[model samples]
Target: MQDVRVIPPYPEANEDGIREGKSKSSKFSFNFNLKPKEVKAHLDKYVIKQDDAKKTLAIAICDHYNHVAECIKREREQGDSKSDSDEEYTKQNVLLIGPTGVGKTYLIKTLAKLIGVPFVKADATKFSETGYVGGNVEDIIRDLVTEAEGNVDVAKYGMVFIDEIDKIASAANLIGKDVSGRGVQTGLL
Candidate 1:
């Protein structure tokens, strides 16, 4: 048989070719083969301030994608005969709250680029309630699909940044439910 090399699911970090792992010697457990510090460092290059947000998002992204990479690895090793279990993988969706032009979109966009993943941005204000004449919330998913070249599986794994999410908050003076806002939020959920 010809010799075959099995490459690791994740590439080694930096130019040293040394792989990072969880160890009692280290202060933090770098899960999914990703070092959170490295991620934060990359964020620092493009973003200024928001250190807390950067750290939080870095950890979250590392955790989420590491889980996904582990899932893919498990499925590949175990073949396609898996069954649905009581618990399933849950995505950690982030909601960025800040004033306009605070680099909310820029932060996410930069992180996506750094991770080499497809990024989709949509304004929550642009989407109208169902049965209305404006854009649909599902359009974000559709855009992701397009970004992935019509591959549903690829699109599902990508990031969709819906800006201006706070605009959907219900008005205090309204008596009943805000159908338009509520409808869009429900659809997104």
Candidate 2:
């Protein structure tokens, strides 16, 4: 391995500046393996005046790929897991936080399409807290599993977007109904 110091030439001790140099400890990076032109194509679909978020995520995806590629190369040299090498894929998930109609949902759907993954959308509000008194919270996962039934390939490597999640803010006394909001987040996790 080459010994090229990764530390800054002139260290600036600011809060924003990275104190320590990059290390191999953080090998866990998520990547979808999208090409440069394909990335540009996806970004182009969105409207103008909002290139910052798009560019940041795009670069982040590329950086993640680079990091994982480096690890893969080292693993090949050391003869590591064969399955990972054969199936070059990474489960990279992202969350969008913004107001409605700001294209947050559109971004997830567009990204899924760009990456050729099965995109699934769900409304968290429509789900009731009273699942017949005995029903559990795992129905969310069951619903997702059902959604991706026929498309196994894409389902294995796809996206699920939950909208209107702010509906059940308080499950303890939801509109005078004894529902559980915490249960939903727990089920989601």
Report the error of model 2 at residue 27, Å: 28
For all predicted structures, in order, the TM-scores are 0.74, 0.53
Pairs of residues at least 3 apart in sequence or in different chains that clash in candidate 2: 171-181
lDDT string, candidate 2, 69-173, tens digits: 555556667776345544665534555666777776776666655543346687766555546454344555555455545433224344577887777566554
Q: What's the lDDT of the predicted structure labeled candidate 1?
A: 0.67
Q: Where is model 2 more than 4 Å wrong at Cα?
A: 1-32, 35-41, 59-93, 129-149, 169-180
Pairs that collide, model 1: none
Instruction: Give the best candidate by TM-score.
Output: 1
Alpha-carbon RMSD of each model: 10.2, 14.6
